[model samples]
Target: MMKSLITTLLLITGISMAQPNHLPTSIPQTMSFQAMITDTLGNPITDGMHNFRFRIERPNPVQGGQVHVIWEETKQVAVVDGVISTVLGSVTPIGAMPFSNNFSLSVALGNEVISVSPLTSVPFAFNASRAMSANNATHADTAHFTHQAGHAHHADS
Candidate 1:
């Protein structure tokens, strides 16, 4: 019984140690993703270069959304010990858009589309730009209302 217990403990420890680390919680302009590659037989694909295609999709209908690809790019990535890391917008430009709604990310290895992950947080840079625009508008409004000695303030009404 003691021997069996020791063996079980070692097996659990090994499995825990082999688990992959978590991906980044947030990304800015150049978005990145990390994933573990496994084969059909549940073995880790180690030391390989593969073509990966990434897509940002907008969901249609909102509730039960369909995939509408908004941005896409294909790049060759290196896989080491079943782990692959990639930047989504490095190859293709991530054009500016109003990120009012949540978007989903899809990764394709060669031709097979793997899975879609929901992007919960908006990129910090995009949010910053929006804030800057709001500040500019506020500044303009202040300038329009405040009349200087040499300047004439024209009221719309």
Candidate 2:
């Protein structure tokens, strides 16, 4: 019995140590994604009730092909004032960490012909940006970067 216990303890410790310090310790990380989709005229779009589908496309198949699109979440759209916002709150399953293809959020305006592109959000890494210069030089708002396992944001910054 003592021998078995020791073996189990050693195995567990080995597995734990093998995990990189930067990676998240938890399994399947579900995160919320939020975005505002507007029209070219800067008006909140009201195309019936829209639905926001959060998709984390798996990275590609190649050894390092951006991970499979492993994470996907869906939620209805909500309009506050004139701006429309889409939020999938904690819907993604834990362990769905796909390699980061474009972390994309798509808004279904219900019409493909008159589709609204301005309402679309780019990959997950991009945050809403504001221009600090008169020329409107755009820089992402860094306050919203998410912490993921095996990823280091502070060190990258």
Candidate 3:
């Protein structure tokens, strides 16, 4: 009998707040993914290397709503005492993913899929990034509007 493995997924993002006047030119698009592999008996399986497939999916239905796969990639990861740690987007850039949308993660080991789990709120950092960019643009637009209004008032005088 093939023992089924259980995996626990953890998602992490790095977010930093800059000063009002100092905005970062760019934000990192990578996220950290860690997993622990264990057997039914709750014992960690110390596997050397395994091909782990990860999928980020959102609900999309034809009539109502169905699950759709937005992004997927298989990577060879080293498991030490059943703990696997790797940075997502390192293999394939996930910058284009719709992080603002609700998504879930699916994990597969070899030909057998292990588990499908809901993603945490950590992905909101991507939306936060967009907000930061919008803040900068808003400031620029306000400045332009002020300058333009000043010129118009001067012309009226």
Candidate 4:
């Protein structure tokens, strides 16, 4: 009987440990978010349809440490075997907003909300913003030179 009990306990522990704790380490260019959902009892919530709200928020507020929501959207999602995959920018564009600091993710389902998850990697969109700023600066420099050339007319000669 003790042997049987030990086996049962081991199986339960293994199942509970299988749940994913962090987001993917690689930053995806397409803004796809994937997660595994489980209940408080560590049982996977699978084969269900649910409404999920996702939000990206600044970790530290400009005034205080209070979080500020930068982007949010609600979507009807399908869960298959405890895994959920959704493209974030599909419903609402994440846009070219600058991410100066690492942001946290908040997910709301039903009345329960989880807001402690920090993004594992910097967003691809953040790098894109830097690239755009560099391009704009280059164009501004060229425009300044062009303006100077136009003003350099021959002085009455």
Worst 10 residues of 4 by lDDT: 148-157
Query: Sorted by TM-score, highest first, which candidate order results?
Result: 3, 1, 4, 2
TM-scores of all candidate predictions against the true structure = 0.56, 0.36, 0.60, 0.55
lDDT of 3 by residue, 83-154 (tens): 999887788767666656888888887867778888876577668666544423323333433342322222
lDDT by residue (88-113, candidate 1, tens digit) is 78889777656776688888888998
lDDT at residue 16 of model 1 (Cα atoms):
98
- Runs of candidate 3 with Cα error greater than 4 angstroms are 1-24, 63-66, 123-157
Would you list the rank order by lDDT, best first? 1, 4, 3, 2
What local distance difference test score does each model get? 0.74, 0.47, 0.69, 0.71
TM-score of 2: 0.36
Residues 1-157 of candidate 2: C-alpha lDDT, one tens digit per residue: 9999999999999999998756444443544434455677877666555655555443355767554434455556665654454334455454633332344433344343222122244464353222211222223233233322223334323
